[model samples]
Target: MRLELLYFFFYSMTVYILETNGWPQQGKHELRWNHSYTGINKPSNPIDKEVLEEFYHSTAGPAWLNNAHWLSGDPCESKWYGVGCNPSGDVVELDLSNNLLAGELPDRLSNMKNLEVLILRHNAISGTISPLLFTMKALRVIDLSYNKLSGSFPPQIELPFLTNLSLSNNQLEGYLPNHWNCLNLEVISISSNMLQGVLPNGLSTLSSLKYFDVSENFFIGPFPKEYSSLTSLETMWLFTNRFNNSIIPESWNKLVKMKNFQADSLAGNLPELIGVNWSDLEVLIVVDGHLTGDIPESFCHLKKLKYLHLFRNSLSGPLPKCFCDLPTSSLVSINLSYNQITGTVPDCFDNFRDLRYFYMENNNLTGTLPRSLSACKHLYTIDVSNNYLVGSIPSLYANLKDTLNWFELDNNRLNEIEDGLEDFIVTLSTKFCSLYGNPWSCPLPNYFSGKEYCTARCSSCNTLEQHSSCEKCLTSTSNCGWCADGRNCLEGYTNGPYYPYHCDQSEWVFGNKTNC
Candidate 1:
């Protein structure tokens, strides 16, 4: 029996076969990865060294990407580089947005099938999307915005789990996909595309789609009646299309969930707000459309209305007294640019305290600028250009102090600058003001030259290096706070040399000077 046992043991040792243990370690040389790695702190493969290596190599190489330490296969933190992980050693999220990676996406991306969220926005990646991608079954969010991706989206696409897909600012062409049964897709943005042809009727069946933007496309004809079924739709931006010949569907009033509703160029008048349930509507923007007739009187029902943008349309009539009262109660912005509305800005505008932005430029409203406008205490942005209104500037800043950040009263009949116009000088001294086009006296006001305008305005030379719009700060939610050092909050904004410039006690002059 001893001889038989010895022989069997020797045979087993010679075979050297062992069952695979989970990702912890593979002997001393082979490391295990993809363990819970805390799901985020480690690679999911649980047994590979190349995961982090590939991550840093491919993702624009952010500063924190260098500090990542690997304890076996797990990383230590996600806020370091927008990395997320699942229970296994797999990387489930990678959001290296606006990190400015240059060049085309590498084809080796097929390796990350476990990724659920992939945000690679504001980079300079050029080239068509790779067909060699992993089926990406787990991908829920994909934001490749402001990149240089061109070519038609793959027809046989297989991303069933995708929810938020923002492919804006890319050069993608071809008609929008006609059929998609993706029940889970919520936000799909293909704005600023060259896509042509009518939307397929089947698209309206995507009841779960909350935000669908096909703006700036070549789509023509009436929006199909089926669009009314999208009861869950919240933000529907269908502007700048060739649908001017189409009738504004009366069923549009059913978009009760619509908040940021924008649909311009559909020929017709707005329906009366009596039966319309725009009660939850915050932003009612319809610009450059063919809608004519007076501003809807029933619009006063929107107690929640904040922004009312009705620019570049043929709509006529005086501002309704009720409309002024409600917007004053709740609205922050009111734009009626490029319209034929005549008569004075409702004197009731004086009651608006939340009014931040007010633009009635290029309208035929004939009268002196209302002195009551000065009463909107929170007024920060104002543009009343190209109008027939004549008066010395209302001197609203005397009351606002410094809350007035943006003020444009250009191309009006105002013949003189304000007495305290030098205060605007302080704005030009820093980097937060724009004033021009109003006729000023020869012995030019105070600080801020026309050259200052030339320098301060985002010139063609500086725009490439700098963001033209607020996009730089807008992309990041917590950026650009004036109370704290703006340099600390925003990357490009600087008041002084970098220590990242924390707004110390010295930056504040409290007693009488408030930091508005």
Candidate 2:
């Protein structure tokens, strides 16, 4: 019985040895990599190591691709670049962002079953996203933006755990996939793509979605009515798309947390009290649209609002009267240019203490330049041209000489520049301030006479740069003289060491001085 037992055990051991050695017929060194390894801070397990080696080699092997650690070495032990692993040595995150990697994502990527984050953004990667990736339930962030990826997205893709999915600036075409119910998704940026078709209502179903940007797409839309249900949304950008229908303000009633809303070229009327529900709104830009109506008085309720851009619309009526009454207002930039807005320019500058850019150009506004604007020390640019504004310009602004870089007051009915403001005008860089297309008397102040719109009163130069055509009749000589540094000077003036001298030309002529 003892002899039989020993013979049987030896027979079983021989069979085992033969079976293992027979695998070498497939490949010799290949089978050596299948061995199990164990240690603290060791390389990734054999399964993950094999998967990563396939990926690196499959990807375009650039000269800068120095990740030899992921090929044969243990990734956790050698600290493979952009590879993160868990305590048990399982690869969990692979971030190769901005690496200039130039290749399509390999098909075997799904082998990393434990991966949670895959960020390959700003690469030259091309190809359709593998549907296998969406099946990876552990993935939380999948950012493949700024790639050359091209292909229709797979329909009905499901990524249950995804939180941020950014595929912007890719060559991805076709309608967005349908029935996407990623409840944990907080951000979905697919802008700057060729994504066509009406925006799906399934997007609003993402209860945790905070930022959704589909701008610069071919999305035809009667914007999804279910978008009102996106209570968690803080920013929504639907700009530069070819939407068919106008926005319904009531459909956005539940978005109280919304802060930034931009929809350029969208057709809609200014809802009377949009601020009633969007009280937390901060930036609202709806430019180049068919919007019409008075500025909403409810805009005053947005205490945190900073940028209000309603430019190039048909919005009529005076600026909202209540804007000045809002005590907590934080307005800094307000653009309402090229609109049909009527009524005198309102003096709400006192409320916009932080005002930097104020554009009301090409409207039908009629009024004197508001003195309140002079008190806004931060005011840098103001364009109220092409209006019926009468009265002389303000004598001075708080930081007009320094901060005010652009001031456009042309095409108005102004009769004169304020007497004391001539010095300020002379110090200003020419063409930064346009004071023409009005009824200034001929032989205008040398500073203002250089503009082409001032041609009715003076020999003006049409171009802003190199005003060689603006020769002036000097008081000292009946012969025409060249204007340099806002001063009328003889032709040889530039030959002097101090060529373009500060003649205080405008003040000399208009400020009761006699150096003209």
Candidate 3:
């Protein structure tokens, strides 16, 4: 057959000289307008066009694509910069995101065989990521996130119609690929990578996963007990990693369409009906986790909770006074600082009328301070510092002295401060009141400015003169003029030279100063 037609004409002229741009013959390749796609060449394969001119002449992609518009024309009919083509000329989408495109990352782009979307995000694209790009099976969205890409990560992910897989902040390390079935995966972010081992179970067969982030990465054990049955999981970020798991997998209550669950140092307890299956949870962070019991009163059935971080942890009883009788109208910020919580303080701010940040600082809480929190007219911040509180300081915070900004009642056992809220702490100008270890009385240094009015041991107990020599004497060098069942009369001590002066009339002076 005439030598089989001369070996089929030398294999179609060596595949048409490796598909155009004059195959590796070095130099002399100017094609700016000698252009000719043969009348709009409808090529359904065969126009590798030297795979994007050898990926714009080996990497640095002509400094962000425009080398005179990609060496002039026909990159699938001239529309480049984030190229996308189809109608037979192939090359389906390649968004060079944040296009400051630096070097590396050009494994002939897996020869674009109908490539379906490969966004090089925030490019500065460094090396290592070409495992022939998961053999591109018409890849569906593979974002090389925040590039600076290093090695590892492509052990096996066959990309069967892949759905949004972002190699987050790359520097990607090993582990992870146990074969993510890729069954139409739905959003998988390898967050801040430096990825370590464990986390494989082929990702519980990604049943159409809905946002899964391996946060901050260094991923260690625990987390993949079939990922709480992934019922189309809805946003899960395993924070900071090194996951020394203590427990959070009670089959995660079969994730009833979970809505944002953050984790780091996750320890036990917290599953007490977790708001009856996370009633469409809206941001629940488990901080410094090692969480212990009591916080559940079914979390008042999370009516779409709006940000509730369980601070520090070792949680104890008393904060579920129906959690302010829930229906908190979409509560915003309620951090329970350092736990071991005990009773009182829940006057239920008239059901937190859209309350803003209220942390129960260092718990063991005890009564008085909740004058129904002035019905939270968008209360700013009120931290109950070192608990065991007692009355006064809540003159309805003078209607939240214009959106009160942090009022931390330092070391409690509080005693008097209300001369009707002392002009809400002398006209607040960016409030921050922390009455150090209370015993009150000491606001008159020209009524505020600096330490806001107390502490220097309440300004040396306001130059002493009975207010129990500086608020019911408890060391300012104890003038202890009676009260602890020495039969009252210690409201700011009186009887001329303090002593058995048991002057009770509910003794709480320091302003109208009488009955001593």
Q: Best by TM-score, which number? A: 2
Two-way lDDT contest, 1 vs 2, winner: 2
Candidate 2 is scored at a TM of: 0.77
Q: What is the lDDT of residue 35 in candidate 2?
A: 13
Q: What overall lDDT, based on C-alpha atoms, would model 1 receive against the true structure?
A: 0.59
Across 16-87, the per-residue lDDT of candidate 2 in tens digits comes to 322342311100111011112323375577888888777776666444345545544678787777777777
All candidates: CA RMSD (Å): 23.1, 20.2, 22.2
Candidate order by lDDT, highest to lowest?
A: 2, 3, 1
lDDT of each: 0.59, 0.67, 0.67
Q: In candidate 1, residue 268 scores what lDDT?
A: 72
* Residue range 1-516, candidate 3, lDDT tens digits: 974463344333322322331231111111111111233335334445567777766666657744444656566666655566676787677666776877786787788777877777776878788788888888888887787888886777887898888888789788878877578988888788898877888788888898888877888867767777678887787776888755777777888888767675677778864688867887677766678888778878888777677777788988776776666787766777778888886776677777777778778787788888788888777888877676567677788888877788877656566657656675553467776665444443345545445341353343335343433443443334334322222324433213212233354332332333
List candidate 2 stretches off by more than 4 Å: 1-40, 65-72, 326-329, 441-443, 446-516
Q: List the residue pairs that clash in candidate 2.
A: 42-77, 43-74
> What lDDT, from 0 to 1, does candidate 2 have?
0.67
- What TM-score, computed on C-alpha atoms, does each candidate reach? 0.64, 0.77, 0.35
